[model samples]
Target: MTSIPNVTLNNGIEMPQLGFGVFQVPDDETTAAVATALEAGYRSIDTAAIYGNERGVGRAIAESGIARDELFVTTKLWNEDQGHDATLAAFDASLDKLGLDYVDLYLIHWPAPARDRYLDTWRAFEKILGEGRVRAIGVSNFQVAHLERLMENTGVTPAVNQVELHPGLQQEELRAFHERHGIATEAWSPLAQGAVLGDQAVADLAARYGVSPAQVVLRWHLQIGNIVIPKSVTPERVRQNLDVFGFELTDEDLRSLAALDRGLRTGPDPDTFN
Candidate 1:
């Protein structure tokens, strides 16, 4: 099995730097997809309640015979489940669906600033963490202001911040803040949902490295210190995505990719998405 490097979160828990994501994958297909990833040496699996595939993910984990401690499982609370009580209840539902007693990490799927319940929801997350039901807690798609308010009003800082980040939409400012605050930056659409694969710079890097464009992009994410979860239902692609630890990009190559950032966002705006 390939050894995936671990990124220590703000709370001191180690998470695989690269993981498999089940974003759009249907519930029925998710099991096979997750199984393929596990067989390909992936120890981390990212899913969400909104994805409606937690059961499939749990099935794969149960059947894999992989030790629970050897695997990292992550799930999220959806937008509708944003209040303290609702968040706790929703988390129970997620655990039930996942067939696991504890999750490695749990996240608030979005800020949903209009609802203004994330602070309350995070308090519940703290409660969950206190109960030792989760190893770490985080928020996804949170902007700088959201993070600022969260830290100001809350007692615990988020361990990770998962967001839609790709070379095309390199979240430099947000990432910098994460570094300053000891938060791990986890990228969801690390490849821009295939939007950045065709970029000339990425293609050139792939050619130079004798690898695929996806590998080049994934490698960029790792080199730049982003915990990236790339989703693919195809067996070959799933294995190929995890085969990104072999090469290192030089400073010039890194700069080339950096210049490709156009602030392109493939998802909803965090501040206004509520």
Candidate 2:
């Protein structure tokens, strides 16, 4: 079993540092893929309403017969679903599809600065939190400006901020900001969406630890205190991702990995995506 420790959220929830992500996972194949992940001992499943696979993921969990309390399920509100009432309706729809009364984490999918309604959306999230329908609430792809505005306006801080973090795009400044605000940083594309898998540095680290490149990347995220949710369809790779508990990365190895951070990104910049 992986020896990674669970990181406590601002709300006192202990979530596994490494989770299973289903970003591009299709609806038809979502169930089997999630079932495989559950069998592989993944306690956390990260999905989104935009992914259009919530039902499949829910079915997998229901069929697994694993008690709801034993799992941590996270989903996000799409860009089109912003504001107080719209967000509540969206949350209910997502919950209905997932077959859960409450979610472990619910995030604003994007800042959508142009829409200028995340503050309102967050207010709705707080409402849900107060009702105890959701264990934790958060944001995703949020820049510093967005976070600051939210803090200034709502006077509520999110439990986590899921971002596009990988060895290539370190986002050190944002991570520091999250640390200052007591918000955990969760990495969405932890593998750079497969862009850094073949890098010589990652390859060398994998060779040193007798693990796959993915394992080395996931381990690096763990060392940096960032929760990582790596996505995969193949059973072998999914299993390989979770078996990163034994070895420890040396200081020298970590320094080398830091040098690999080129600030490159495979996803659209949230600041201008809208």
Candidate 3:
């Protein structure tokens, strides 16, 4: 099994850079997929309360026979649960569903700027962090503006910012901002949901490296230092995704992949997502 490297968050919490994600994964299939991922040596598992598969993810963790301290589990607070009291309640509910005393990381699922309640929601996150119920706190789908507002208002910087990132959506400016602020950049939909797999540049690199196109793209993410979670229920693909540790992309290859960026997003825009 390949060992995945860990990225230290702003809070000094270590998180596996190459992990598993259960986004659109159905609850019924999540357990088996997560179990396979665990067996494949993926120590990080990212899910959200809205995904409705926390129970299944928890079940897999329980049955994996791995020690609780050895695995990193992450879940999010849903948009509906976007107030101080409601966010606290939602955290308890998510913990109950995951069957864990605490999650390794918790995130505000989105800024929901239109709602204008994320600042209040973040206060709850700070409280939870202070209570030691979560190892780290973060935000997903948050733009630089949202981050700036949160920092200015609450005086707390998120440990990580999980966003829609891939070869097609490089997010250069946002990533530079994160680097300056010490916030880790995590990529969801890292492969562009298979859209980048067939690109001629990606295909050519895969051939050069003797790996799958998916692996090529994932390797690029690793080289770029983005925490990437590529999801696939198939056991073989699950293993394949983590097999990126062996190859290194050259500067020329990196340049080629950089050219593939077209400012595309596989999900909603954070500034407008309500």
Candidate 4:
């Protein structure tokens, strides 16, 4: 089994720096995919209610015989479930679907500024945290302004902020802000959904390291201190993704990758995605 390093959240909970994500994986295939990841020594699994595969994730966890405490499970609340009452109800539904009494971390899937319910929804998250149903709470797809407002109006600061980040969209300013505020930056599309794999710099580094382009990217993510969850349904790719802890990228190589950032976004804009 591979020993994945743990990133301690602001709340003192330790999460695997690299995890497996089931973003586009269908429900039926999710179980086998998750099982493959687990067998490959992955302890953290990222899923969302919106992904509609929490049940599949749960099934894999149940059958793995891997003790619950040994695994870290994360699921998100959907955009429609943004209000306080609705958020709580939706969380219960997610817990039910996951077949777990408590989740390692729960996040608001998006800020959804137009709805203006995240503040209210976060209060419910705090409530859930207080009851010990969740180890930590956080938000996803939140911009700087949204994070500032959330901290100002709320009693608890988010432990992690999951977002679409890749070599093409480095998010330097946002990551700096997270560092200042002690929030862990978790990247969803850490590889740019295969968009960054074709870059000359990435390929050169991959060749130098004798590894795949995806491993180079994933290594870059870890070296830069981002908790990355790379999704792959293929068993070989799933194992390959976890094999990124062996090498380290030097400062020059990092700069080369940094220069590749063109502010490319592969997902919806958080500021306007109401």
The regions of model 4 sitting more than 4 angstroms off are none
Q: What is the C-alpha lDDT of each candidate?
A: 0.96, 0.93, 0.94, 0.97
Candidate 4, poorest ten consecutive residues by summed lDDT = 265-274
lDDT of 4 by residue, 1-274 (tens): 9999999999899999999999999999999999999999999999999999999999999999999999999999999999999999999999999999999999999999999999999999999999999999999999999999999999999999999999999999999999999999999999998999999999999999999999999999999999999999999999999999889999999999999999999999998897
Write candidate 1's Cα lDDT for 156-250 as tens digits. Answer: 99999999999999889999999999999999999898999999999999999999999999999999999999999999999999988889899
lDDT score, candidate 2, position 158: 92
Q: What RMSD does each model have against the real structure?
A: 0.6, 0.9, 0.7, 0.5
Q: Give the residue spans of candidate 2 off by over 4 A.
A: 1-4
Candidate 1 TM-score, C-alpha based: 0.99
For residue 138, model 3's alpha carbon misses the true position, in angstroms, by 0.3
TM-score of each candidate?
0.99, 0.98, 0.99, 0.99
Q: lDDT: which is higher, 3 or 4? A: 4
The reply for model 1, stretches above 4 Å from the true place, is none
Task: List model 2 lDDT by residue over 63-149, tens digit each.
Answer: 999999989999999989999999999999999999998999999999998898899999999999999999999999999999999
Off by over 4 Å in 3: none
Model 3: per-residue Cα lDDT over 1-274, one tens digit each? 6778899998889999999999999999999999999999999999999999999999999999999999999999999899999999999999999999999999999999888999999999999999999999999999889999999999679999999999999999999999999999999999999988999999999999899999999999999999999999999999999899888999999999999999887788888888
RMSD of 2: 0.9
Question: Which candidate number has the best lDDT?
Answer: 4
